[model samples]
Target: MSTTQIASPRVALVTGGSGGIGRAVAERLGAEGMAVAVHYAGNRNRAQETADAITAAGGRSVPVTADVSDEGAVTAMFDRVQETFGGIDVVVNTAGIMLLAPLAELDLDDFDRMHRTNVRGTFTVSQQAARRVRPGGAIINFSSTVVKLTLPTYAAYAATKGAVDAMTMILAKEMRGRDVTVNAIAPGPTATPLFLEGKPQQAVESLKNMAPLERLGEPVDIAEAVAFLAGPARWVNGQVLYINGGVA
Candidate 1:
């Protein structure tokens, strides 16, 4: 049977759905016959484009705008999803920012901004999902392979993902009987606008070759991992699945 013929329909909220990985995940989930709420912080146009593509392909979707770090905004976004779809079955927190600088040269303000979006944003979204997501649902968070790679100039960024890893484990245990699986996906050197912006061709090539696959991961690669956790990987909970083609 095709995904569209699945007996039960699921609803998913993918934050940062305007960008590369998040948009890919949203589109993939929509193709799986899930109603998707594509959440964007500031790019409503891109979000709408994602929703339109999903709808045109015979899936249901809507674009939502919210600041993930704002408690009230995130809450309202969740409320909108619940009202639109009855209940949320999957929540993917892909909204994040990366600021690169060696610890010694990093601006404190930059560090704070990263923490606000990457760490606090995940916490706020996870809190809402824990309270609202239905049984047998999944909550997927985004981490980074840099957390383990320990690359210089990524200290601030990796710190935020480390917090994400910690939260994923704790949230999984907290929702012990809720039947909601929580996990994080760590992608290495993906070809996203966020990753490519301001990067030199030489630097990009170096990162591409670091992986055993000898290529940078695509957004679709990470989306496939998310689809697994969201659909059939019930036993895989509270772990960070590194989807970087063995780059760790």
Candidate 2:
């Protein structure tokens, strides 16, 4: 690219940026000239690795640890933004946990874990973005197609994302007249660590074939959807964009 074509950078915060779709979103946003705040729940090494990759790509990023579900931790995480990037422009709430158990078999503790991270954590990060980000900034939350599929064992996990989708619409309306946008992305089946857990290789293969596209989504696929929502897709607001490869 010519020097004259260089774009000015912006600030982006991606919770759970250490792994999975969060990492892809951070890297993609970084490539788009957004300085990244890579928030991790506990994995400093992975978060730093993500930040290092961004730096190697000629984009700026910083790794910061926060629970995302904890109000104080979430607040402190934003405080670092004040020091590192002055103010934030885009906030992506990708920090989520998926605990699969049939509704009758679900444990309360597992339910809390999913709710605390997927639902409450999203709320914490989104509320922070709502309060602090600039006029054209955004709040993007992660949902899952499991909410639509109603997959048997995913009862608790799906419940949380269902709530996220509902809250996203309400929050978008709550923003009322602000130039900023709020939206959610419900990815179908992505090839990510979380998606692979406990499944045999054959099962994974079969899952991939379940999509009409005949392949599981890459993390980058979802990240690209997120990039559009966070940056260029201006008219798309208060909607849940499902990147499911037409699985329905």
Lowest lDDT block of 10, candidate 2: 1-10
lDDT of 2 at 143: 93
In the range 1-70, model 2's lDDT, one tens digit per residue, is 1122112467999999999999999999999999999999788999999999999999999999888788
Q: lDDT of each model, Cα atoms only?
A: 0.94, 0.89
Query: Using alpha carbons, what is the TM-score of model 1?
Result: 0.97
- CA deviation > 4 Å runs, candidate 1: 1-7
Residue 174 in candidate 2, Cα distance off native in Å: 1.0
lDDT of 1 at 161: 98
Per-residue error for 186 in candidate 2, Å, reads 0.4
Best candidate per lDDT, number?
A: 1
Q: Report the C-alpha displacement of residue 36, candidate 1, in angstroms.
A: 0.2
